[model samples]
Target: MTDDPTPGTRCRACGGAAGTVVLDLGEQPPWDRMPARDAPLPDPAAPLRMWLCAGCGLAQLQTDAAVAEELHGVEPLAMTEQSDRSVGRLARAGLVRPGGRVAEFGSPHGGSWLPRLTGRGMVALDADAVSAAGRADLVVDFYGLLHEPDQADALARRVALLAPGGTLALQLLSLGTVLRDDQWFDLRHGHYGYWSLPALDAALRRHGLGVHRAWWYPLSGGTVLVTARAGAEPDAGTRRLVDEERALAVTEPSGFARLQAAADDTHLLLDWLVAERAAGRTVAAYGAASRAVPLVCRAGLDASLLAAVGDASPAKQGHRMPGSDVPVVSPDELAGLHPDRVLLFLPELLDEVRAALPQVEASGGRWVVLGPGPRAVEPVSALSGC
Candidate 1:
C-alpha cells in the first residue's frame, strides 16, 4: 500500500498525460528472465506497478517488463479445452463464417487457430501475413495484446487488418475477475495492459471499432471473449458487460486498491513455508510457471524451503526458479520425491493436474493450492472459494 515509487506519467492505450497508481508489487525479476539452476540467488529487479488511465479505462503496467530472453511456456490443458469451446461458440454465433478469412495474432504459447479454422471451411492467415493476404473477416487475439509495449498502436494495427464489417474476437483475462479475485500476481513486468469491458470499449472506439457481443469463460480465473466490428452498435450482452465493469468501478484507480491487500498477503506464503519446514512437514511444489517466479523470489525461498518445483514443459525442467535456489524438475522427478505437501501455484490447472498426477494422492501425499495462504485441494477445486 504505498504509492508507486516509480510513478507512470503517461497511459499506454490512450496516450493520456496522466493516470493514477493502481497496484505496486515493488521490484521483482522479470518473469521471462529465469536464472539457471546454479547461476545466482537474486536476479535483477524492476518496478512492477499497474496504472489506471483516467481517459481510458485500460490498466497497464507503468513499469518496464522487458523480456531478458525467450523461454517456452507450455499451454495448460485447461486453455486447450477452453479454445475448443470458444471456437465452437464463436462459430455458432456466426462470427466464424463459412469461407470466412481468419487471422490469428501472435501468442507466446505455441499453438495455432489455423487448422481449427481451415477444418471449418475458413481461410487462415497469420496476423503478420494479413498485409499481403489482405484484410481478414475475423481476427483473433488471445493473451497476446498485453505483451505489446505500445498498446494504442497494437490495437490500431489489428483493427486496420480487419475487412469492412469484419469481427475481431479478442479473448483476454477479465480485469473484473482479477479485481474480484484479487489476482495482483497478474501485474507482472512483461504484461503491459489489463482489459475490462469498459476499458476495452474505449480503446476500440479509438480505432472505429465497437464491441457488439461478448462471452465469458472460467479459464484463467475468468476470460472474456469479445467480438467487435467496425461501426457496429453494442448488443445487449456487450452493454451488460460494460455495466458490470461500471458496477465494479473498473475505470477508477482507487477501485483497484483491493489488489494491494494481495500484494501484502504474498509474504504469508513465505511464513507458512518456513513454519512447515520447522514442523518437519516435507514440502515440494508443482508448476514452475512464470507467474510463480516473483512469488518464489520475493518470499526469499530456496530449495531448503521448497524441495523442488515441477513443470511439464521440458524447456523449464532443468532451469531453476529465477532469483532463488529452488530447482525446476520434471513432473516424474517431483513424483519420485513424494513430499507430504505439493503447493499448486496455478490453481486453474487443478483438474488437469489431478488426472495426470494421481500418483501424488496414491502415495499418501496431498496437493495444496497456493493462495494468499495454502489451502488443501478439495474434491471440487475453486480458487476464489479456497
Candidate 2:
C-alpha cells in the first residue's frame, strides 16, 4: 500500500528483499481494458517493471494503486471463455471426478462450469473469497495466484482448502518457456508474478505441498498445469522438468540479458509494418486477443496501418480495438477483403490460423508474425494451398 511505483521489493514467494530489476517495459496500461466506442480513453500509464528474486528466482512486477485501477476495468467475459478449455483439461487430468467436490477460484462468472461438472459438487468463488476450510476435493485456480502480493500465503490457504489427498491445480504462464523466447507481450500489469518450475517448486515446498503431476499446454502462448498435494513426494517427472528449467538458466542473469535483447528488438516488427504500409501494400492483422492490446499500443498501430483486425471469436467481432480505431472483423470477412499481407499478433496460434485461412494463401497473401529473430515473416508459398 506504499505510494512508491515499484511496489514489489520483496519476493512474492519467499519474502526476500534481494529481488533485482531485470527487465523494464516502461509504462503500460491494462492490456484488456477496451474502452467503449464513445467513452474517453484511459491515460497516464503506470510503470511496468519486472524483477527477478535472488532468493527464490521468481519473476514479479512492481504493482501499485494505478496498476490496480487499470486492471479493474477489464471485461471478464472474454477471460471466462478462454478458461473453458482449461477447465475441461483439468477434468480430463483426473483432478475432477464424479461425486467429488470441486472449487474454482477467480472464476469470472459463477456457475459457468456447473453444467460441465454435473453430478459433482461445484462452487465458484472470487479470488478473495473466504469460507470454511478443508472443503474441496479439488481446487482449480487458473492464472489467479500470481496476481497476489503474498503468493506464498495465498497458496498456503489454497492448500488448506483441499481435503486429505486432494489436489490443488494451477494453470499459469511458464516463465521457463516464455523467458527463453522473450515473449514480452505476456508481461502485463495484471500478472504480478511469473513462475518457472524451480521457483514454483520452492514456493510449494515452503508450504508443505509438492508437485504430484504436471502438464504443459500451448494455450496462452505457453501454460503449465501443475497439480500439487500435501504429504506427497516429488515424482521423477517433476524432478526432470525442474532440472530442465535449471539447464535453461531461467533464473540466472544471462537469461535476463537474453530476454532484454529480444524485448529491445520488438520495434523491428513495428518498423516492418510501417514499411509495408509505406510501400502501398495492404496490411491486415489476425487475432483480436487481449494480449495484442499492449503490442498495438506500444507500436502505435491503428486503422491506417492495419486495415482490419480479424479474429475467430464471435464475441470480439464487430468491435474496435481498445486503444486503436482498428475494426475487428471475422476471418471470413478478411478472406474476402483479400489483404496483401496478414500480420499475426499471436504467434502461438500461427498454425491454427494458417489452417483456417486457406483462402488468404490461395490469393497469394503472405503472413507475418511479429516476433524477434527468424520468426518475422512467413512467405505465402510456405502456407498450404487450397
Candidate 3:
C-alpha cells in the first residue's frame, strides 16, 4: 500500500513552520485499516520525515503521499467499538436519556450505537454520501463543510430535524489535543477540519444550537464529546473546557518530548529482547493490532525474533504489522510456540490476559510489557497480570 505523505512543507492547520524533525519513520505501510489479503494493495510510497508545527504544535505531512484520505471508507466497525462506551456513558449521563432525540455528525454507516439510540428514540444522521446501513429511528445525509452555503443549509436541516428539547451530541477529535501534542498521526487525510473548542462552539452557535456540555474523552490520544441543543446558547461548560485545555497547556512541547522519550525507551526494551534472543532465548509478541506498531517499527525490532504477534481480532490474524511485517496470530498460538517470553503490546488488556495466564502457562512462559511509558517484566504467574 502507499505510504504516508512526506513532510517538508508548511503546516496546513496553523500555517506555521515545520519545526524540529521529531520522528523519521522511513518507509512504512498503513496499519489498523489494512485491507484483506486478496484486495489489491496501493503502490508503496515511503513517508519522508514527519515534522512538528512549532507554532501550533500539530504534526502534519509536508506533501500528500497517496490519497489515503480519499481511499478512506466507512470504518463502521472501528467507530462502533470506539464510540459505544462513550455513547452509553452519555446516555446514562442524561445527554441522551430515555426518550431523548439526537443527531450524530459524520455518522459512520449508521453507527452501531444508532440501533441502541433508535431503541430509545434517537435519530442518526450521516454527512457522507457513503455510509453503513443500520437500524435507527431516522437516517439523513448531513455533510460538514466550511464557508459553503450548502453546508449552512445542511446544518439548518439537521438542527431542524432535531425535536425540541432534544440534545445534539458531537463526537469529534479535539484539534487542541492534536496540535498541542504534536500528534501528527492525527492529521490523517480522512480528517478534514480540526475542531478546537472555540471552533466547535462557533459552529454549533452558527447553526442555532447551544453547547451544553464539552468534555475530553480518550479516543486515539484525545477527543471531545459535546452535547448541544437547538436555540441554547454556548454554556460555561464549553468555555470551561476550552480554558482548562489551555491552562493545562496540553499543547506544550513537554508532552511530545515525553512521548518521544517513551518511544525511545520502548526501543531500548526491544533491543534488549533482540539481544536476549541472540543469547538463545525465544520471544513471542502478545497483543497485535495496537497503536504500538509505529513505535515498535520505529524501534527496529527484528521480525524473525518474534514468533508471532497475538491478537484477538480475527481480521488481523493472518496479516502482518505495518512497518515490521511481523505475522499476527491468535493467542492460542502462544501455547503452541512455548516461547520463553511474551511481549505484551496491549497494556490496557493486561488484566484480562493475566487472568488467563494459568491457561497460557501450559506453555511455560513469562511476559513483559512495553507500554507507552516504560518496560516492565514479570513472571506470568506473579501479579495476576494486573
Best-matching candidate per lDDT: 1
Where in model 3 is the C-alpha error above 4 Å? 1-26, 32-43, 48-63, 67-85, 97-111, 125-168, 172-211, 216-224, 228-244, 251-266, 355-358, 371-374, 377-381, 384-386
**Residues 1-386 of candidate 3: C-alpha lDDT, one tens digit per residue:** 11223444565544555455554545555444444434444425455344445555444344444433221223333345556666676767665545543444543213345666767666445433323342222222212322122333544655555544556566666656654554433333222344456545555676667666776766555767766666655557667787766664434434345434443455566667778689887777776543445555656664567767776666667766655656677677665777777777655456566566545554656667643433556655554554
Report the lDDT tens digits of candidate 1 across residue range 1-386.
33434544677888875677788777788888777787866677877778877788788888675677557878888878888988888899887767899888856756656677788989887677677447899898867898888999899888978988789888888899888888888888788889898888877888899788888888878888888887778778778877987888888876787888777887788888889899988789988876787678667888898999999989888888877889999889999998888899888887788788878877777788865688877533343364
Residue 373, model 1: Cα distance from true site in angstroms:
1.8
Candidate 1, after superposition: displacement of residue 33 in Å? 1.4
Model 1 ranges with Cα > 4 A deviation: 1-8, 379-386
Better of 2 and 3 by TM-score: 2
Clash number for candidate 3: 8
Per-prediction tally of clashes: 1, 0, 8
lDDT of each: 0.81, 0.69, 0.53
Q: Could you tell me the lDDT of residue 239 within candidate 1?
A: 82
Lowest summed lDDT over 10 consecutive residues: which window, candidate 1?
A: 377-386
Q: For all the candidates, what are their Cα RMSDs to the real structure?
A: 3.1, 4.8, 7.1
Error of 3 at 274 (Å): 1.7
How much is 299 displaced in model 1, in angstroms? 2.3
Question: What's the TM for model 3?
Answer: 0.65
